[model samples]
Target chain A: MRGADILRFSVHALKGYPVRSVLMLVAMAIGVAAVVLLTALGEGARRYVTGQFASLGSHLLIILPGRSETTGAHPPILGETPRDLTLDDAFALLRSARIRRVAPVALGSAPASWGRRERETTVIGSTADFQRIRHLKLAQGRFLPEIDPRKAAAVCVLGAAVRAELFGPEAALGRWVRLGDRRFRVVGVLAPQGQSIGLDLDEVAIVPVASAQALFDSPSLFRVLAEARSREDLSRAAADSRDIIRDRHEGEEDVTVITQDAVIATLDRIFGALTLTVAGIAGVSLVVAGILIMNVMLVAISERREEIGLLKALGAASGKIQLLFLAEAGLLSLTGALLGLGLGLLGVWAGRELYPALSLAPPAWATAGALAVGVGAGVLFGVLPARRAARLDPVQALSGR
Target chain B: MIRLQAIQRKFVVGDQTVYALNGVSLEVEHGEYLSIMGPSGSGKSTLLNIIGLLDHPTSGQYWLAGKDVTGLADEERAEIRREKIGFVFQLFHLVARLTAAGNVELPLTLAGLPRPEREERVRELLAAYGLTARARHLPGQLSGGERQRVAIARATVTRPEILLADEPTGNLDRSSGREIIELLESLNRQGLTLLLVTHDPQLGRRAARQVQMRDGRISGDGRGG
Candidate 1:
């Protein structure tokens, strides 16, 4: 038979039983849509995390006081007790050619009181370079003065929320605020930067690292944030930080230096696997839909036995008979895949609208894979019934026995 | 133009081998209007199915147009059936979903005839069958006589040399049955070989030659009234 004629005959057969055809179409369509939508969600989460990490800083490295074996999980619990990373270690890292800036960090929770108002807040201690290295924007006055790293300068910068709480609408720059029995003059108020990397930047206070260590009564630095001179120098800067910190700590290699790219790449791999797993789970539905097609096609073959017998009696080859049934399946799956694409896209649109922060888009591979699998399932599952139809005894079929 | 020799067909029914056709030999000339009549289980329909290539005889040498086709492959037999034979059934066997014109176009379409020629042939056949007005109507929408006419049109649309009909008028009323018989006779008069299978003796006698079958064997073969 001509290809067009075969297609026409198959279409006619499907149309003859509209409800059954639609049922098969819907089954296949739902299967494909499930794959597409679930993968979109998985990929969307990956993009959201990557974007969050990207917002942390570019070409950045963090030096923590403990050695962490893994890339992006909790620090290892059972290891050699890590030595303290101090101001001397941060100073030594600045000598490396690849290291552009280093911000020695110390953290504590302390209460800040100005006149009658007092609020307990997280206090981050670093040098003036903290503003530049951490991408903090200044709203008024200026950031901490570029002074000696060892000097405990009694100066501070207030986050936007802290400024509002301490001074209300007043100009609070250069005002003294007491933190843990010490008084510090605020030199700057930070512009409102929202939450990033788990820190609500608008709700904390920034002080010099030396003063924060004195207030917290600890000699060890919490972390050292370093920026590379260029994007290509990130790995070199991390290596230099690790080597310099090890040298400062008597060659113990006690600190873990992690690059921003390493963390992001790890996250990417983890989420990529997650996306594949989700798509695989959704693939089960496609197989189920294929089985449905097989069942329906078998019933269809039996119901139309007399028609098939008539066609055979009119000289249709067995292969032609098989082709007719296969064509029916192919048509159903093709249409269903197309419908699923549209439905999946609609679902993606709805998801984006519901959660504006999520970066949701169907991955190209997922879409293509879903469509390929849908049609493949149709053809593969179609084989048994088509073969049965081809093998039917025309005499028995014609007799309707 | 057709010959059958010692055709035998057997069925295993619950450990009992039932002979559907046994040592049946017959020769049919070109343009002959032949009818095979018998009671139920007499193998008249079985013989017709074998002649139409819808079934295979257990052991037989069948010749069509001087070609020994008994051992031909399935596809080869289908090719011959496509080019040399057509079928009409008691139920009219019109595909329920297709319109009258579409039904008539099926054989030509299966033969891979181009669209224009197929459309032309379908139009001519529908008009000849007096189904022009109902050309777009589905089989369910047509009456008994109309459906039979559509079936006849479909059978002849491919211009096959032989028309094998199994109980073509078995389901029709008396007037519709007469109409169908006249239509089959007209095709036979046009030199298309006709083979009709029926149990009605009156219908069997209308043919030019009649073969009466009983117990899987041909009991009588002679000229009909």
Candidate 2:
């Protein structure tokens, strides 16, 4: 038959049984929508994490005190002890040509009391260059002075939230706040920078590294933050920092140095795999939809046996009969896929509105994949029913046996 | 022209081989109006099905228009059926979903005629069948006589050389049955070959030639008025 006529006939058949057609369409549509929405969520999470890490600053590297793994495959008889990374090791990293700045970190929690207002909060101890290296901005006064490394100067910077709590909207600069047993003058108030990488920047207090070491009564530093001069120098800066620390610790190499690119790359790999897995799980629903189409088409064949017989008696070839049935399946699935595309996009839009921080958009591949699978499922699942219709005995069918 | 030689069709019914058509040979010239009449289980319908190429005889040699068609492939038979034959059934068998015009246009559509020509032919055929006003009406909404007329229009839409009908008036009322019989007779008189199968002796006797079947074989063959 003419292609147009075939399409018209199939459309007429579907319209004849609106409920059944809608059922199949809904099954296929839900399957496609599931794939799209779930993949959007997975990809949104990936983007969120990538954006979080991006805000930490570019060409950055972090140095931790302990190695995550031992050198040899054999288990350490006494759990290989790690050497402490101190301020001296942090100063030594500045000697590398590729390293632009290094800030030794000492972290501890202490209660700060200003008159009657007292709140317990985390204290981050680093050098004056920490402001530039970590991309911190001052709202009032100046950051800690570039002072002698060995001198213990009592000066502090209050985060936006900490300033608000202790000073109560009044000027927080030049105020003395007692932290634990030590009293430090607040030299600066940080700008209102929100949370990043799980650390609430607004609630923390920044102090000079020597004063924090004395306040916390600890000799070892928590970590060291370093910035490379350029993107190309990041790897070299990381290697040089590790080597410098290893040499200062008498060749122990106990410190772990991680570049920002490496961390972002690892996160990307993890999230990429997660997105694929989520999409694959959603693909199972498509298979279920395909099976539904098969079941419905089988029922259609049985119900339309007399119609098939009539067509055959009207000189329709077996191939034509098969084609007509397959056309019906294809039309249903294609329509369903289109409906699902709209639904998935609507879902993504709703999610974005509810959580503005997340970049939730359906990927192009997901849309294309959904469409391909939809039509392919219809045609593949249609084979058996179409063949059955084609193979029907016209005499028996006409006799309604 | 059509010819069937020693046509044999057997049915295996629970270890009993029932002969539906046994070594039945028949020939029909172009434009000849013929009818086959028999009681139930006498294989009149079976003979019609074989002649109409809806069923294959187990062992037979059949020729149509001087071409051997017994061993023809399914698609080739379908092509011949499309071009050279049309069928009318007792149930009218109009596709319930299709409009009257759509039903009449089916064979032309199947033959891949262009839309304009197919529509034109359908309009002409519907007007000829006195169903032009009901062109958009579905079979369910059509009367018995109207449905049969639509079926006849569908059957001859491709201008087939022969029309095979089985119990064409079996489901119609007396007046509708008379109208259908007269229509078939008029088509036969217009030099279109007609082969009808029926059990009604009155309708059977109206054909130009009659063949009587009993026990899977032809018992009598003679010319009528």
Candidate 3:
């Protein structure tokens, strides 16, 4: 039994029944393609969501006003509402720990303009530290400068989209934009930050906190945007800020200190579950493909009964007979897996181009896993037919026409 | 080289027991040519099949080369047949898809001989059987006599100690039959034990010895000389 001989015989056997061989190969291809497509999708979704979270500034934390419930009653009534985060609490957090800089942020919707072009935009009001805290970059001019207390300089950084639409290719920097009744000078134009999960970062307008508060007729307190000296001290610095804010508000627990890492972990859980759910749904096709393989193999065995008998009469061992059929199954599946892997990689590449936000890249492990799954199905589903062929009685088989 | 003591072969058909060979005793020595003559149901083919190790008797002691082969496994029996016995059939039993040379090389291939050696042996056997020119012809392309010659060449390529043929000449014309008998006799003269089954008494008498079987039992045995 030369390997060449077995291979040659396999080719001959397959050629003897072209339609059946093609059908078997089709079944194997479906199985391998399903496994590759589903697993790749799972990996792509995870990367997409993770990238979105990373762009949102992983060092920042969100603080909402509430006393988070730690205990519950049998007949639950509403929990206590804590005092709001005020200007004093923001100032107190600024002094706590080794925090390097802080910007009191205030968010409001305002109709903005730069001479005859106006659009309703979300206004983020903060100080110079807001630029470093949110990783904002300037396309032109400069960001707001650090100002003295109670100083209200009317300057703004126009987002890329707002600048393009309002100024129509003109230099937006050093121009004046009206926010509500007051006019603010365009100190800078922020670079284009593409959409993250459908929220267009390029559509926003940033202004100084004092100017925004005075123009909107708001209170002095703000949504504090803080930055640490280093990312390593983020957890400790966040806890210290919470303590200070808690103390200034008379331990009222009004603010929620949630780190970007915490939010990312939550997002990972949601995306991970979604990927698994889709993969599980696609797994049904693989199982159906396996069953089809078994059925086709059984049919092949029945059709080749006489050939097997002739080989047996020539003194071929039972193990050799089993090996031949198993080889057929393996060859069919291996070819299918290779084709499916190439198809899957091409699909991932195409998907990445179609949706750059998805950022699809098929990992090496995915290719290897798909190949293993294909060969394993071949062996597993091939066993029954191989055994049946091996066990056929030569006397009766030879007698069959 | 071959002996059977009180061989009994039975088959059950619809709850009725049929005896293919019952209480049959025979012997064939090296270089001896013998023929078994009987009707279709007289167990002639059954006895030949038993001697070739293609079929087993229900109750019998079969000795080949002085070893009791009655208890041998199927693989062991096949090995013995490959090494020590050759078989020819009435229909030639040539693998229809194979060329004359390929059919001749089947035994050598089954014996796991190297490809070059097997091909060389097939060439020699085909030349010896006067089929060298038709070696590339498939069984379908060759005449009945040529096909039988290829089958005989295939059977004898391993240089077996015994040749068991069932009606080797029944399907051939007289001239072809005579040629096959001459070939078998020449090989017999070279010390191969030959047991041939035939319905023609004239063909049976050509052997050195003859045995007659009627109704699953040996009816007569005598020296043709």
Q: Against the true structure, whose TM-score is highest?
A: 2
lDDT of 3 by residue, A1-401 (tens): 66755665566577667787787777666666665666677777778777776775756654545555321111113445545555455656667555666667777878987777889987877778778877778899898887763578888998899889889968877888898888989999899987754457698788877777787777544356566656676788788887887777777656666656665676677766775665556555555655677788898788777666656655566777787888887777777667767776777777778877667665456557667767787777888888889888754565463
Where does model 1 exceed 4 Å of error?
Answer: A74-78, A111-120, A153-155, A160-187
lDDT of 1 by residue, B9-83 (tens): 998899899999999999999999999999999999889888888788899789988989888889998888888
TM-scores for the candidates: 0.94, 0.95, 0.80
User: What fraction of the reference structure's interface contacts does model 1 contain?
Assistant: 0.79
Model 3, stretches more than 4 Å misplaced?
A2-8, A55-58, A62-91, A102-120, A148-154, A174-185, A209-225, A252-256, A260-290, A349-359, B6-24, B31-56, B85-110, B122-159, B162-225
Which stretches in model 2 have alpha-carbon errors above 4 Å? Answer: A69-80, A113-117, A164-171
| DockQ for candidate 2 | 0.80
- Model 1 DockQ (Cα-based): 0.81
Model 2 lDDT on a 0 to 1 scale: 0.88
Q: lDDT of candidate 1?
A: 0.89
Candidates in descending DockQ order: 1, 2, 3
Summarize candidate 2's per-residue lDDT along B70-171 as a digit string, tens digits: 988889888988998999999998888889998898888889999999999989988887899999999999999999999999999999999999999999
Error of 2 at A278 (Å): 0.6
Query: iRMS of each prediction in angstroms?
Result: 0.9, 0.8, 2.9
